[model samples]
Target: MSITVYPARRILTMNPSQPEATHIAVDGDRVLAVGEVDTMPRGDGCVWDERFADKVIMPGFVEGHSHALEGAMWDYLYLGYFPRHDADGKQWSGLKSVEQVQERLREHAACLPAGEPLIAWGFDPVYFEGTRLTRRELDEAVCDRPLVVMHASFHVMTVNTPMLERAGILDGPRVEGIMCDEQGIPSGELQEMAAMFVVFDALGHNLFEKVSSPHVLRRYGAIAAAAGVTTITDLYNPMSDEAIDAMVEVTRSVDYPVRLVPAMGVLQWSAEEGIARLQAALPRSHERLHFGLAKLMTDGSIQGYTARLKWPGYHDGHANGLWNAAPEVLTELVQAYHQAGLQLHIHTNGDEAVELMLDAIDQALTLWPRADHRHTLQHCQVIDHAQLRRAARLGVCLNMFANHLYYWGDIHYQRTLGPSRCQRLEPLASARRLSIPVAIHSDAPVTPLGPLFTAWCAVNRRTASGRQLGEHEAVSVGEALEMITLGAAWTLGLDDKIGSLDVGKYADMAVLDQDPLQVAPAELRDIKVHATVLGGRVHGGD
Candidate 1:
C-alpha cells in the first residue's frame, strides 16, 4: 500500500497518555503510524501529504445515536426551528413566540410557487410556555396553505387544519395523543408514533423514494463531511430494504463521505419478527454501511410531557407521563432479540421506562445467558444514579442524549422533573464512577446532529436558562470528546476498526479549525470543519 503522511500542528489520537501527536502516516485506508515527524516510518518511501500543515487533526466526530435519514428528511422539508437566514444559510433554531413562527412561515410560503406544503420543524411548545400554539394558531398562520409544524421532539407534531383534513384525522377515532377539544374535535397536537404515523402515511410513499434520491443523498453526504462527522449511528431509519439499498448505492458510488451504522427502527415487533425483518433487509456489510442493530422507541419524549416518568412528573403538577409500549410488549421483544443474537437499542427517556428496560434486560439474561452482548439503552435522560449502577452490572451500554442539558435542561429542572430529580439527569459522572461505558448522542431532529455541541453540552451541562444543572455530573473536555469518538465506537462494536487514529485503524479522520481541548467550552460549538478524510480520501471542507 502506498503511504501518505499528514503533518499537523497537533493530532488528537485520543490514545490516553499520547493523545497529541505531530504526524499520522496512512497506508491505504488504515493508519500505519502516529508519532513525531522523525520517528514515523515511511510506507515504502512515500512522502508526507503536506496538506494539513497548520490544522488540528482529530479522530473524526462520531454521533453515536442520531436519525440521519430523518434529519436529512427534515432538511428536505420544513425550514428548521433555527432561522433560515437566507434561501440557504446557517438556520436559526430559536423562536420566542407564535408571532415569530408565523413570520417565518410567511417568508417561506411567499418563496414557493403555490400549493406546496409549508412544512416547518423544531417548534417546541415548551419553548413558548404559557402560550402553546394550537392547531388553530397554525391555521391562522398559513390560511389556505397546508402546514405541519413538527415538534423538536420529533416524536410529535402539530398539523394545521388543511393537513388534518387531508389526512382525515380531524374526526378520526379519538387517539389519546392527538390534540382534541372538549367536544372531541381534533386540536392539532399529534403525540407519539401512533399520531405522527397519520401524517407520515398521508405524505404518500416513504421519503426514501423521493427526498433521499441519489442526487439528494449525495448532498446529505456532503453535509455530513462538511460537519466533520465521519460516523453516525442512524437512530430512526424506516429500516426498509429499499432504504438500505439506496444507502449502500450512495456509499459505493464514490466512497461515502461518512460511515453509516443504521439501526433498524423496530416498533410493534416481536423478537422473532425483528430478527426476521433484519434478515429481509439482507444488507451486506461494507466499510461505510453496517445494519446490524435494532432501534426501539419504547417511550415518549419528556418535552411533550408524554415520557413514562415515576410518580410526580412535570413540576407544574402533571401526573405520571405515558409509555409508547407496554412493559409486557417490551419484555417479549427484548427476550426474543437477545435469544436471536441480535443487538437491541431501546429508547427510554423516563426513569420509569428505564426501570422497565432494566427489568426486561434482567429477564432476558436469565432466559438467554450470554455475556458481552453489549445491548445498548439509548436516551437514558431521566435515569437515576441507582440505574447507572444497575446498567454497569448488566453490561448494558448507554448512549446518553447529552444535548438535553443545553436544549431542555431548564425546562426539565423547572417544569418536567423538578429540582430533585434534575441533578441526576445524564449522570455521566456517576456512570464514569461506576466503570460504565457511556456514549453521547444528539438524537437529531430531536437535537441537531452536531457532535461538537453535544460534547460541549456533556462537558459544561449548561442549561438554556444559563444555569448549571449539576456541576458534579460534568465530564472533562477530553472525556467529552471521547464520548463521541472512542466511546461511541465501542458502543457500535467498531472500536478496534474505527475509533482513534492508531496503527492498523481505518484512516477515518477530520481536520478542525481548532483543537476542541484548547478552546473555551463555549467556543467549542463555534469551531468549523476545515476538512474531512475518510478511508484516506479527502471528501469535504478545505
Candidate 2:
C-alpha cells in the first residue's frame, strides 16, 4: 500500500469510543490507521505528510442538505449580497428602509443596459420593519426598466411597471397570490406560491442553464474546499436534468476536492414515474457522485411569514403560510419512494408542515416498514416534542437548519413565531434525546457554509442580538462539530465510507487553525481552515 502519514496537534476522528487521535495514515484514497503520533505504525514504504504543528485535524464536513443550484446562482451573481463598499456594488441586500431600497435601485438603474432586467436578491421586508414596498415605490426606483427584487425568503417579490406589463399582470384571470388592495390594483408585494411563480417565470431565470456552467461549478467547489467541506448533499431541482448532467460532467473534468451527493428532485414525478426515474438513475449512483435521496419541498420559509404554524399564527397575524404538497399527495409520494428503497429528504420549515409530513411518513411506514430506511426531514425549523417522537418512531432523520438561529433567529424571535415558539426552534437536544440522528446544514446562499459558524449556532443557540434562544438545546462543541462532520455523513448514508478518520474510510480531512472544541463558543465563527485533504490528495494548502 502507498501510505502517507498526517500528524497534527489534535485529530478529532469523531469515533464514539475513541474520539481524538494525533496521527492519521492514508493508503491512497482510504485511511490506513488513526492513533497517537509517536506510536503510529511505520513502514519502509510509507510517506509522511506532517502538517499544522499548532493546528487541529478533523474529518471534512458533510452538508446533509443544501441547494447546489442556489450556491451556483450566488457564484454567478455579482455577489453584492453582503455589503462590501465598492463603486460597482449594485446590491440592496440589507437596506433598512423603503427609501434606502429606492435610492439604491434608482442608482443601479441609471447604469444598467436599457432592455436587460435589473435583478436583485436578498430583500427581507420583515427586518426592514413593517414597511412593505409597493409597486409605486418599485416603479419610482426604476422608471421604465423591468425590475423584480425577490424577498430573501424566495416566497415573495416586488415588481416594477415594466415586469408587470411584460408578465401580463395588468389584465389576467386574477392569479392566486398577487397581493392587492380593495381596488384590485397589483400591490408591490407578491405573496405565496402563485404570485411567486408568475414573477420567477417572467424573470426568465432558467436556473439550470443560467447557473450550471464550468465557471460556476469550479467557483463553488473552491468555496467548499476553502471552508474544509469535502462533501455536499445538493438538494437538487428535479426538473433540471440538464443541470444534473452538467454537474456530473464537471466533477469528472476536475479533481474535485469536495464530493457531491445530489438528492434528485421528486416533485415533478408521480409515484410510479418517480420510481422509474430513480431506477433509471441508479446506474449513476456510486461513491462520490450520485445518491438516492429524493427531495420534496413541503412549505416556504419562516422569514417569508408563509411558514405554517400550529397555534395563533404569526405574532403579527399576517398569513398562516402555505403547504408545498397536500398531506395526501405527500403520503402517496413518500410511500412510493420508501417502497422503492429511496431515501426521502423533505424540506419543512413550519410546525404544521412538519406535523403533516410526520403523518405521511407514519402512514407510509405502516404500509412498508423498514428499520434502516433513513428518511430525512431537511430544515426542520419548527419541530415540537410530539413531532420529534413521531420522527423517531418513523425512523426519520432530522437535518436541523441550525443556520436559521443566525440568519433569521432575531426575526423569528421578534416577529415570526414570537419569543416562546422561537425558543424551541431547531430542537437539537430533543432530537438527541429521542435517539433521532440529527445533522446541520448551511442551506448556502441562504447562509454561507461555514461549519465553524454552524457549530457556533448549535453550541450557543444565540441570535444576532447575542441572546441565547434555547440554551438547553445547545450541544457540546464536540457534538456540534459532529453534526457537520460524522453526523452529516450518516445523514447522507455515506457513514460506511466517510465522516470519520477511521481505517477503510476515505482520506477526507481538514486542517484547522485551532481546535474548535477547545475554543470559546463565541470565537467559533472566527475559526479558519488551514488546508484540506481529499482522497489522500491535498486540494489547496495555506
Candidate 3:
C-alpha cells in the first residue's frame, strides 16, 4: 500500500503519547505514524504532501448530542435569534423581534410555490416581550396557505389557523401538551413530540423518514464537515430499518464525510421490542454507522418551562415541568436496555429528572453489574455537583448542554431558575474537579453546531446578555478544548478509533487557520475551520 505523508505547521493530537507532530503518515485510511517530516520512514512509493504546511491540524471535533435533522431542516425557513449560515455558505440574518419573524416567514412563503405550506424551524419566542406567539399573528403573514412553525426548544410548535383547519385538529381533545386559550380552544402552540406529531405528520413531511434517503444523509454529512465535525451522534434517530440501511449505505459511500452514531429512540418501541430490535441489528452495524444504542427522553426543555426541576420549582411560579416518561417507565426501560447490553443515552435536563435517571441507572447496575456501561446522561443541564458525584460513582458520563450558557443563560437567570440555580448551571469545572468524564455539545438547530463556540461558552461562561453567569465554574481553554475533542469521543465510545491522531487510528483531523490554544479565550469561536480530513481525505478545503 502507498503511504502518504501530510505535513502541517503544527498537529495537536489529543493523544498523550505524542501530543504534537509536524507530519502525519497515512497508510490507506489509517494513520501509519505521526512524527516530524525528517523522522518519518523513507520507502519506495511514499508520497510527501505539503499542501497544509501552514495550517494547524487537530483531531476533528466530536458532538455527542446533536442531530442529523439539522441537515434536512435548512429546507425550511430559520427564524432564530442568532445569525446562521447554511451548508452552501448563505447567511441567514437573526430575527430578534416577532415582527421580523413574521416578515421573514411572509417573504419565504411568497417565494415558494403559491399555497404550499410555509414550514419553518428555530422559532424561539422565549425572549419576546409579549406572550407566546399565537395563531392570530401568524395569520397576518399569509392566511391562504398553511404554516407549521417549530419552536427552538423542539418541544413545541405553533401552527396557523389554515394549517390547523387543514389538519382538522381544531376540535382535538384538550390534552396535556396541546396548549389551549382562555375559552378552552386549541391555541396555535403544540407542545412535546406527542402533541407536535399531530401537525408534523399532517404536513406530509417525515424528517426521520427523509433520513432514509442517501441524498439527505450526504447533505447532512456535508453540513457536519463544514462545522469541523468528524464524528457525531444522531442522538435520537428513530432508527427504522430503512433509515438504518440508508445510513449504512451513505457511510459506505466514498463521498461520506462524517461518522454517524445513531441511538434508536426507545419511545418508538416497547422495552422488550427495543431490546430485541437492537440485538438483531448488532451484527449489521457498518464501519461508519455505529449502532447498539438507545435514547430515552427523561424530561423536557428547561427554557420552554417544561423541564422537571426539584423543589422551589420555577422562579416565575409556573407549575413544575412535565415528565417526558413516567419515573417508573424510565427506570424499567433503563434496566431492560442495560441488561440487553445496548448503551443508553438518557435525556435529562432538570435536576429532578437527573436524580431520577441516576437512580434508575444505579438500579440497572444492581441487576447487570457491568463495570463500564458508559450510558450517558444527555443534557443534564441543571445537575448539581452532588448528583454529578453520584453519577460518576454509577459510571454515567455527561454530555452537558454547554451552549445553553450562551444562548439561554440570561433568560434562565432572569425568567426561569433565578440567579442562584442559573449560576450553577452546567457545572463544567466541578465535573472536571470530581474526575467525571464530561463533554459539551451545541445540540444544533437548537443552537449552532460549532464546537469552538461551545468550548468558548464553557471557558467564558458568558451569555448573550453579556453577563458571566458562572464565574467560579469556568474551565481553562485547554480543558475546554479536550471537552470538544477527546472528551466528546469518550462519550460516543469512539475514543480508540478517532479521538486522537495516533498510530493505527483512522486519520481524521480538522484543519484550522490558527491554533485555538494560542488564541484569546473569547476568540476561540472566531477561529475558522478551513477544512477537515476524514480517513485521509480532505473536505471543505480553502
Which 10 successive residues of model 2 have the least lDDT summed? 78-87
TM-score for each candidate, following the candidate numbering: 0.94, 0.93, 0.97
Q: Tell me the lDDT of model 3 at 309.
A: 91
lDDT tens digits by residue: candidate 3, 1-542: 88899899999998888889999998888999898878786779799888889999999888888887777788778888788887678999989888898899888887888888888888888889456898998998878899888888888789999988876678755446777799877778877777777776777875555667777778878888888999888877877888878888889876788889888889889988888888787787766778887999877899888899998898888788887667898899999899888789889999999999989899889888998888999898879888978987998898999999989998899888889998789998988888888899998768888888999999999999799988888999988888988998888788889888999989888999998879999899999999998888888885
Q: lDDT tens string, model 2, 1-542? A: 67788778999998886799888888889888889877676779787876566779899988777656544555222222344221222442556567777888777777777877887666777776757777888887786778877666666778887888778786765666677867988876777656666766777774434445656666667778888999876775553566566667777744777887877667666778777876776676555676567887777888887778888888877778776667678777878888888888888888888888888888878888888888889887878898999888878899998989977788888887888887788999889988899999888656666778888899988887778888788888888888998888888888988888888898998889988887887898899899888888787775
Clashes of 2: 1
Give, for candidate 1, the lowest lDDT window spanning 10 residues. Answer: 79-88
Error of 3 at 249 (Å): 1.7
Better of 2 and 3 by lDDT: 3
> Model 1: what TM-score?
0.94
lDDT string, candidate 1, 435-478, tens digits: 89889988865666678888888888998768888888999988
lDDT of 3 at 36: 88
- Total clashing residue pairs per candidate? 5, 1, 0
Question: Cα RMSD (Å) per model?
Answer: 2.4, 2.7, 1.5
Q: Give the per-residue Cα lDDT of candidate 3 at 129.
A: 48
